[model samples]
Target: MLAYFGPRGTFTEQAARGFATPQQELVPFDTVPAALTATRRGETEAACVPVENSVEGAVPATMDALTEGEPLVAVAEAVLPVRFSVLRRPGGGPVRTVASHPHALAQVRHWLAEHLPDAEVVATTSTSAAARAVLNGDFDAAVSAPVAVRHYPLEVMATDVADVRDAKTRFLLFRRPGPLPEPTGHDRTSVVCTAADRVGALADLLAELALRGINLTRIESRPTKDRLGEYRFYIDLDGHAAEPRVGDALAGLHRHCQHIRFLGSYPKAEPGGVPAGNDAFVSAAGWVADIREGRGA
Candidate 1:
């Protein structure tokens, strides 16, 4: 079974639907931590949660939650288009008050301002929750996924509501540590680590990967929260961890960093690129092994 951060009709639900096979039963949790915690507790096989947004960068709640508590590893991921619609009761009055999650509200800020300048914006826990508010007559309209209309007795009043034309969000399905997925050649390996405090610490940390020809896809740092200057970095690299180049790069990182946590290696949502130097790395390692066995000059 699969669990998702939702009350249903969330973008997470949409992403989970796509990530799960037809046989996987999808369940919903109230919060990101709750969904992930379920996976940690073995209440469910896996949980789906949003990790990043094109318009919003990293989702702090997800980044921090993944790094904290019992360890969970992302097994698969999906990227969904950031599309929203304004929904209201079929014969409802003008949209005097609009409700949605803060992230959803931010995406349609300009659109709402242009179309309903007088409408008051209210924050809800989830977009589906916003639809429930409209159903309860607490708000006149809700900014929600297009799918919300199917779940609630609401009709779309405004369609394709977005300030940015083509925004997207990335979601990951996670489960407790176990055997990792095999390398698909085109895959992603993610980790969170803290640099050893020194001159050019971050630079040196990145160089560990670069020297091994591992392509860094994304990198972001969050405060350790334990101290003022301490930070933990969240990184995504091209290629699966099982790949020789990636494995070696991580070994180099292990020796170079203050701390590290493996967040699993999984297939990319839109796979294509393979890291450079895998063949060279494998060959070089073979040569070194040969020398150690006294088979080389």
Candidate 2:
């Protein structure tokens, strides 16, 4: 079974369904952490949760769950285009209040301000939850996915309400740690590194990858929660750990970092889709390996 942050009509459920075969079951949990925790406890085979959105950046709950407690390895990822609608009851009165997940509210902030400047906005656990609130007569309108309108007795007062038309969210499928996926050339490795409380420590950590010609795709620092000033870095880099140079960079980081957690390496989502292999990166990897083994100058 696959567990997702849902009540059946969430974008998370939509992402999870993409990976489910007819034989598999999809379960819904109230929160992102709840879904992931179900995977960690073996209640489900995998967890599908949103990790990042192009507009809102990182999802803190998902990040914290991955960074803390027993580790879960990311096995795959899905990118979904986000488009929200302003939904209301069929005969509802003027929208005095608007409700939605905080991220959803933020995505449509400009639209909301222009259309309903005085409407009081409230937060919910998920967009589907916001739809449920509208059903319960708690709010006159909700900013949610179009799917919510079909699921609940709500009408689309307005459609395509996101601040940006091309906004997208990246969701991850996580499972218990096992053999890492074989290198795909266009793969990404994620790790969490805790730096020592000293100057240049972050720069030094980054230099390990930079010196090896390994490219970092993304990096963000989250509070360690153990202390006020202490922080842990979440980094996404361009190559798989199995690659010689990438492996070398990670090993070098281990020596300087207080703790290093390998999240996983998986095929990166690309425009034309993940290629079987990149001839250029493959040849460069071979040259690097040869130099390391004293076979090249």
Candidate 3:
């Protein structure tokens, strides 16, 4: 199995390490779109990308990639806990600027308010890049994951520094056009559908799900990139499409919705397994082997 992620030390990469088999081949990209492109072009078999964060809410880029990419089915889901660590110069002083990826900066807004209230926030493209900037002494501090401090050779002044407790980010593994392995008792189904710009079209879609007693775990709306009033709905709900109620709701949704896309119905995170924030890095030896050999399942 080939896997793709944001960068070497971002939370997305950290999450991918945990889900991949020892033989999985991992690839890195600066943007989620680039990663999706790599997978779509058959340069890689599967791509891993972040979907949402507990603190920062939805990741718009991931949503956009899913909506635009060709028929990539989600195979597995994982939630990695986000813990921002404060990285500073060797000799700490009155730090004036805080740097981080825009999304990570949003996740730690409360912490920034409480700690560096006067610091200017600069948006970097990725957390790993922010940590590198701080390491080069270009920024006073960086808000990034603990893994970044080690990757970029930076010092951590604060651990779990994010303002919120128990913040988690969900990641999805995407693969194209294949019969996925059978369900393993724990899974989720994700779908994207465009509701009529008209009022009540969205309500009618939800009512269909409600009528079937299907519980929604997440619901998010994205601009359809059309006129200002048009929108698309992305949904994550309990159960798999192979199940009856879920399959029925999707069928009903397709009849009424303008556009319908089923991203995937795949296994969820392993219960009582490794918690999201504390993933250990083994050599990529096994992971690299798995992706190249086609044992991704």
Candidate 4:
């Protein structure tokens, strides 16, 4: 079974469905951390949670949650196009109040201001939760996933509502540390690291990747909360840890950073990129091993 951050009719659920095998059952949690905790506790095989959104940046709760408590590793990822639909109960009426998740509302802020300027907006825990609130007569309308209208008996007031036409959200499936997935040529490795509080520290970290020829796909820093200026960086690189280059880069990171955590290396959702390679590192290791042995260098 798999656990997902959901109340049903959420994009997380949609992404989770894509990850679930035919034999897998999905259990929904009220929050991302709860779902991950379920996996950590062995209640479920894994948990699905949103990690990043093209429009709003990384999900702080998820980024912070992964670094706290027992470590969890993301084994898979899915990206879903973000398009919202505003739903309300039957019978067209003036929308006096609108509700949805903060992220969802932010995506449609401009549209709401133009179409429903007089409508007061409220925030809910999830888009589906907002639809439920509207069903329960708590709000006049809800900005929700298109699937939410089917789950709840609501009509869409507006469709294809978004401030950005191509916004997307990336979700990840996490499980307790164990054997990692095999390298898929086109894969991503993620890690969190704390650099020394000094000049050139961050640049030094990037320099390791640059020297290794490892592509740095994405990087985000979150406050460490232990100190005023200390922060933990969440980095995504285009390669699997099993690859020679990525392994060398990770080794360099360990030597340079005060602390580092390997999240996991997983296949890309949509694979299409240069394959990661490091034949030089492998040959060099073989050469050093030969010399260390009774054999000649």
Q: lDDT per prediction?
A: 0.86, 0.82, 0.77, 0.87
- Model 3 residue runs over 4 Å out of place are 1-5, 54-58, 88-98, 102-123, 227-230, 270-297
Q: lDDT tens string, model 1, 9-78?
A: 8888888888788899989887788898889999999998889872223378888899889999988988
Backbone N/Cα/C clashes per model: 0, 0, 9, 0
**1-297: candidate 2 lDDT, tens digit per residue:** 999877776777778888677899999887778988999999999998888872223378888888888999887778888888789988988999999889899889999999999999999877888889998999989888766765798888998778888888888889999998887677888898988667898999999988877788889987788766566998988888887677878999999888888888887865433333335557887898999999996
Q: Report the number of the highest-lDDT candidate.
A: 4
Instruction: Give the higher-TM-score candidate: 2 or 4.
Output: 4
lDDT of 4 by residue, 214-275 (tens): 88889997778876656689999999988888888999999988789999999899757745
By TM-score, who's the top model here? 1
Q: How many angstroms is residue 56 displaced in model 3 relative to the true structure, after the best TM-score fit?
A: 8.6
Question: Which regions of candidate 2 deviate over 4 angstroms?
Answer: 53-58, 90-97, 113-125, 227-230, 272-297
Candidates ranked by TM-score: 1, 4, 2, 3
- Per-residue CA lDDT of model 3 for 81-185, tens digit only, reads 778888887776788999988878887898899888999999887777888888787898988877676577666778887656777888888888688646655
* Superposition TM-score, candidate 4 onto the true structure: 0.87
Kindly report which residue stretches of model 1 are placed more than 4 angstroms away from their true locations once superposed: 54-58, 117-120, 227-229
Candidate scoring better on TM-score of 1 and 2: 1
